[model samples]
Target: MKFTSLLKAATTVAFASVLIACGNSSSSSSSVTEVEFFSQKPEMQATLQEIVDDYNKSQDEVKVKLTSVPDAGTVLKTRIANGEAPDVINIYPQNADFKGWAADGQFVDLTDESDILGNLNEGAAEAYAVDSKIYNVPLTTNVSGIYYNKDAFDKLGIEVPKSLAEFQDIVKKIKDDGQTPFAEALGDPWTVNGFAQLAWIQSASSPQAANDYLRFSDKGAIKSDEVSKNVAAYLDLLAGNGQSNSDGALYADTVAVFSEGKALMMANGSWALTVIKQQKPDFEVGFFPMPGLTADAPTMTVGAADMAVSISAESKNVDASKDFVKYLSSTEAMQKYYDVDGSPTSVKGIDTEGKFEELADVADLAFTDQQAIWLHSEWTSEEIFWDVNVSYIKNKDLTAYTDALNTFFDTMK
Candidate 1:
């Protein structure tokens, strides 16, 4: 929400302000080490800031200040390229960029931080490891799938779809009932980007097929491919049956629409759980992975480490940064984050009993052999595709979409 909230803010502050603030942290008073903390999860900005404020107030040895902004990922790359890495930051270990960053010595190697790593659930930190070497404190896991309004479904005598055809029939039924079938977050390109990622994952026949979908070596291959066409057609179907103002619907708007029963289902990740709870919908939200093409095989979940903590290897305030990371990994701090996030805690000793029961079906397939992770988890220049996904949804032009992919692929090679 911090990211979306910043989009329409009356007062304007840019990511550069963060670099400017942290840039001066080291040169400031020598009484305490200044840990410049950068955050990627804008939705968790307030909680993280509170944790930092508490840490700073509790001691004089280290002072940690956090910065979170819209499009934090791009801002981070810019800061890192400017040679101004934050002392403390969040890094996705499952990401290709994080792997490259660690290999290039951008993060403090934590493979040897046994004590700190020991605080995490078994295989939690290791699951996102780069070449079997831990590099960050993975806090929570995320899974992507369909979130349906149970009360609406029950009223219609609709069961969760087990196959793509069943899902299509349900969509038709909802449309016939004069209701929007899906609350699409098309207005928010980033939200739609996640939506498109799930579509691609659901369209694939195999894990390699999912990966190969983007591994195009030619320009027209995407437009010519049957599976790719299905992915695009599926987007068109959802957008076609989406809310009337879907083009202007932000992530919050789509969630609000779904919460109010204006739509039957919403495609999103586990993070949407908190937003739905905030709305206090009359219906219980039910989650299901994207159905298989024909029930012969169900689609695997696509997810990765949700909130991961790391310290920059090049931090001038190394000790303070490490201290901040240690505080974040502590049981007390972890509990606070989990309270608001409600994500499956990857940290040890955090009680999450019945915390995300609605997401149990997704959890059953997540982080297992049934999981495919995110397509971008291994791509060097994947974020660029977000705009392409947005473009496809708006224009439904297969040529333009494939053209963008071809250009993006050219850069990858």
Candidate 2:
């Protein structure tokens, strides 16, 4: 027999034997189909495991074992190449790599799975959709906005600024008071790139401008008056008012600096909330949209489903894997996962109230008028982002940076 035929026959026999055992068994314990679940975010490991444990207890037919890795993208890709990918994989939809996998038929087509598809926020789910097919289900979402030290604002008699002008004034006052205005984690170019994304979103004149900002080729694309000027201005302000060592500090160090009351504000996302609280539980905090051209520029913010869950196309136990996926995508399970993980859910009509004020402040905007694409997730190469943004930061030259960006994407085209 051909190798493919032999493999298919063996898989069928194994699946049939497991079904037979499950059908015939009458004991308290029966044969359990195990699915290997691989998670990319180390921070969510414990929460994921708890959810997995609940799913296991709810049903005896399938058991899911989750393994969390810090470098999830690299590890997951290597596993897939080796024909050893996990049965259930948790990854970020923002990642361009996911598109490659989806196009290559590595993921099970979940378009018809209404139980999973119906519960999702349509826009959020669309981020991971390829050719109108839902390849993965969203797990939870994160908000990106400005995190401010409420205590610092109170002590300095500074109300939360409402406009870009007001925000700049506050930064100036904070600086005049001998405090760093923004605790930038520039040691990690990715974190710096986060600021770029925030700037691009806040400065966008409209959703069209924001969406088109990522297109590297159109004539005068990156240099458009609203997007480029505002982004450059924001970076310039950060460079001037940030920590003395802001350019040298890693993301963790910025967290520490903010927690210790050394900086009054930090440009971060909801993902950093847990670490900040853990670093200093009583470090009073609040959030607001990135103040646009005026305090009135729509008060836009960036947010989306952070990670997604998908089943492998080549799994031996597709039925069991779907069961596990369904459990994770449920409202109850996702809420538990988010409660422990401290991120808002990507599912519509799910109650995320009173979870984090940072999330609550932008709840209306995150779901409505101010959605922004996470360029980091869409950018095909990290090298392009790091090189362009980092160089911009060091030289403070917008033209050079835009030129380099176009040059890179031009090569890809």
Specify the highest-TM-score model's number.
2
- Residue-by-residue lDDT tens digits, candidate 1, 250-368: 99999999999899898888888888889999888899887767788766677788788888888888777777777788888889898788776667787667777788788767546
Top-lDDT candidate index? 1
The TM-scores, one per candidate, come to: 0.78, 0.85
Worst 10 residues of 1 by lDDT: 215-224
Clashes per prediction?
Answer: 0, 1
Task: Give a tens-digit lDDT track for model 2, residues 108-200.
Answer: 998888777777776667666887888888767677777788878898899876777887788889988988888777777776655677677
Off by over 4 Å in 1: 1-34, 53-75, 94-97, 216-220, 316-320, 363-365, 380-384, 387-404
For model 1, name the residue pairs that clash. none
Which regions of candidate 2 fall more than 4 Å away from where they truly are? 1-30, 206-208, 211-216, 219-226, 281-283, 348-351, 367-369
lDDT of 2 at 282: 60
RMSD of each: 12.7, 7.7
